[model samples]
Target: MLKGLARIWFCWSFPTMLKGLARIWFSRLTPNSIDTFKELSAQFASYFIRGYKYKKSTTCLISIKQWEDEVLRSYIAHFNKEALLIDEADNKILVAAFTNGLWKDKFLFSLYKNDPKTMADVLYRATKYMNADDALLAHEEKPKKRER
Candidate 1:
């Protein structure tokens, strides 16, 4: 997606490609903590590509409480924005790695060619993780049994 944007960089005429990338990557979130973390990972990578277009975002990264809010869900549904929005407060932050769309290979390859180090930086950030003391979580969330 960003590859598409980069291809059009010379023409300077396609904010839509950027929007497409944002929506594709942003909507993959599930309104859960881990998903939010993953979104952060993706967005950080996109910071280079998206640049100042998202200037009104109050925070560089979103906090967890913002993910749990219902108003955010409603806005995404309303706009038919392929990306998820947490609310009118601008709580959600979408990142490129978290975005699901495929980049046109030529553009991405050109990106790699122009700046190998930048691509490396993006990859390293996406793959890094915090070693917090939080318990290892199970893959499934089971429903609690009803008490008699």
Candidate 2:
């Protein structure tokens, strides 16, 4: 009975851990197709293992541009997501790719004026900008006082 309950717990929690395309793929599987945790693991591994073998190159980061009118926080979030998938990504290369993808904005100017040598430096600077952006957004979102 404990083993059954454990299986039920794992089956319930497993899908919640998936993200993006993997989540979608898991959701679309036919009902009863995965009766056991082993079956589910095998199916998931077989489907995704092929893609795992081909890790995305750093060059992919070069293509992730900040869209027009997109907020700094959004762009940074998107960039970091892709950056995480890369294996042994070079700091210099990541810094260059991140800089190249920026739209003409305050952050771009900042990057140009004080170039970051490493990905850590870039992320640190971006964190400050992201905070500033969030603060500005919060300020804008506050209800203004009504004129008497």
Candidate 3:
């Protein structure tokens, strides 16, 4: 557990923990610009909080399409990642968006044959399809035995 770690130590080490734009932002700051942890935290919040304030709507999910060559698993993963950023997205809307984005395939055919009412149902069904897709890929990758 952490012990004897003082505020000064935290202030000094904070910049090292940052990456990408944050690291660049910290590097650009004038030397000795931050005097206290509270001031540093406040400045960090003020600089980055604007981006966090704008939450994407469910409508944004409608624009996400499963690319021609993208696997079902990857598309579902990407869709789920973006879906998490939305605040209280409706289950029905999520299902619709997810279904709309999918291209014509076994999964899409399954979805059409047995339509899902909730996002959870859609994900559950997708899991089965993803496993099947993986199994098919594994089988295809195996070398065939030559006939004697």
Q: CA lDDT, every prediction?
A: 0.37, 0.85, 0.85
Sorted by TM-score (best first), the order is: 3, 2, 1
TM-scores, each model vs. reference: 0.16, 0.62, 0.65
Error of 1 at 131 (Å): 44
Candidate numbers, best lDDT first, in rank order: 2, 3, 1
* Tens digit of per-residue lDDT, candidate 1, span 30-109: 55433333566666576546553332232322222222343323422332333233233321223332221223343234
Candidate 2 on 32-113: residue-level lDDT in tens? 8767667877988898987753358988998999999887778889999998888899999999988899988888899889
Candidate 3 residues 1-148, lDDT tens each? 2336665576668788998557866787899887766787798788787664336888999999999999888998999988987988998899999999999887888998998999889989889888877899898896989999
Cα misplacement distance, residue 53 of candidate 1 (Å): 21
Clashing pairs in 1: 1-103, 25-99, 42-95, 42-96, 43-95, 72-86, 72-87
- Which residue pairs come into collision in candidate 2? none
- Which of the two, 1 or 3, has more lDDT? 3
Residue 47 CA displacement from its true place in model 1, Å: 32
- What is the alpha-carbon lDDT for the whole of candidate 3? 0.85
Residue 26 alpha-carbon offset, candidate 3, angstroms: 9.8
